[model samples]
Target chain A: MQNPAAPAWTADHFFAGARACIPVAISVAAYGVVWGVLAKQAGLSLLEVMLMSGLVFAGSAQFVALDLWTATPSTLPIGPIILATLIVNLRYLLLTATMRPLVRPGTEKRSAAAMWLLSDENWAMTVGEMAKGRGSIAFLVGGGTTVWCFWMVATVFGRLIGSAIDDPTKYGLDFAFTATFLALLLGMWKGKADLLPWLVAALVAIISAKLIPGSWYILTGGIAGSFAGAIAERRRGYAHQS
Target chain B: MLTSPEALLAIAGMLAVTVAIKASGLLLANRLPQTGFIAAWLRHIPGAVLASLVAPAVVTGGTAEILAAAATALVFVVARNLFAAMATGVIMVFLLRMALGG
Candidate 1:
């Protein structure tokens, strides 16, 4: 069912999304800075770095690509890098799919434009808004715009300030993502019914993270937990009928 | 460092794939069912995916990280504010690091 209170596409909705996403944008900015410094160290030019962040726009994938990059084009390991990036980004397939309901009843152009702005941070924020019964494309766009602007600016800034700061991690900026994510997760917690699926997700994620490489844990744990949640939901339905 | 045509080409390729993945669900929206089991399952994805993201990092992190994460969760549960929770975690990590010499 559609949310009756869902706002229409307006400048206000866009700004609301932007305002809501500012906190998460802080973490995104930190990560973007890190990516910029790393990309610089990986021998990317300023133009290239901006282009990558602007075009690719995937943090983990860009990092993975940097890890595989080399000055010699032939030795760049393009195939492996591309593969790893694809794997790391496989979750977007599911993420975008889940967004369909929220973004529906819009034009092909609007839908396509919204899809381009989709990122993990924006998606999480949008979904959280939806869970709160405030689903709106304007919110998504606003949040996505905020994140995009911060990401681009942070990357360029990081590149310019590269090598000046010795360790960003030492400042505990690495925890920014984890902290932001935890907050989002807590925000999304529905009730006791969510405990099992979340626990399953944690268990599977920890295992997959240890056993596998790259970001496979995210996809595996996500899928496994989805199944567990679905099963729990079915059982609850059965109980109600009985 | 300067931009190379080859690198630009590679970046373009990566961009294409990334965009394709991001748009895949929308592109297939018509063909996919939006009800029943699939819908139910999709509903749980955000929580599961987010939990997975945090769990691995916390598990693999040091004592400071664990403690900070705990603090973050506590603040989130109490305040129900994302900014407050994240700020608590970040600040806690810094404090713990300084105090514990990590």
Candidate 2:
């Protein structure tokens, strides 16, 4: 069946996107503040922290980078840090690819801009909206913009208040990351068929996290689970055919 | 902490690579075959990846975290609301930690 004409990209859509993301944005802001505080404690200047957040815009990568950051400039492990960041952000490739169809064909500039703003939260929001048959470039831009702004503000706020807090984990903020990701994972669960792949992914991830160093577990688990899911799907297809 | 120049360079490099990765998907989307095993496999990747990301964290976290994750998952299953699930998890963790005197 032909898809209905997509809604026009307009300010209203953009604002709607922003409005839709407000709740998620609150969580994103919380995470952002954590990143900011951590970045400050990691010996980053306010300028560097802002720059990293503004330019990179990936909370996971930024957190990993800060963890790898060192006070002594000469001792900073740029190679490992960059490699880890790359590994964490590699998931964006798959995410952006999934977004291809939803993203209306437009100027190269617009496409690039949209892609640049494609973080997991906004991507999830956009995909969810599209699934509901209500999505547009404007909505994406608006949502991304809202997240970007909130992230920056939260980061700055965290930096300013970081020294006073001492231990962020004591407040159970450390659980926020896992909680957020778990929430996202729940949203992505399809049905009973997803059970096998998700189980495989969890097992693989735990093993990899324990055995392997760095962030290789993410890639390993993702690939293993995808393969498991594909094989299951293929088998189901055969069963249906027979 | 890297030197000012080194820090700037690292940030710029990270920006470049991230943008490149993000854009590569769109650029290559047209070239990718739209059907068959590859498509089916790609479709499952997001869930797998997210599960992978969440698993280690949930497994490694202490009892409070485990309990919180369970509560969060339960709320998510029941409500299907992201914010509510996350809030449930965070609050659970806080309360659990407080009750346990952790």
User: In order, what is each prediction's RMSD in angstroms?
Assistant: 5.5, 4.1
Where is the poorest 10-residue window by lDDT in model 1 chain A?
A1-10
| Winning model by DockQ | 2
Off by over 4 Å in 2: A1-24, A38-44, A60-106, A120-136, B1-10
Query: Please, what are the lDDT tens digits per residue for candidate 1 over residues A1-242?
Result: 23234456789888898999998898788768867876766677889888988888887677657756776665566665666566556667777776666654435456656777888888889899878877577788898889989999999998888667556567776576788778878988889989988999999999999999766687788789888998898888888889
Clashing residue pairs in candidate 1 are none
For candidate 2 chain A, which ten residues in a row score worst on lDDT?
A1-10
Q: What is the two-chain DockQ of model 2?
A: 0.51
For residues A36-105, could you state the per-residue lDDT of candidate 2 as single tens digits?
7767677888888789889988877786677568766777777767776776676687777766665544
Q: Which segments of candidate 1 are over 4 A away from where they belong?
A: A1-48, A58-110, A118-147, A213-215, B1-14, B21-31, B78-84
Candidate 2 lDDT by residue in tens digits, B1-102: 324777877788788788888888766766765666777787777678778878998888778888999999999899987667877887899899999887
> What CAPRI-style quality would you assign to candidate 2?
medium
- Model 1 lDDT, residue B66, Cα: 97
To one decimal, what is the Cα RMSD in angstroms of model 2 from the true structure? 4.1
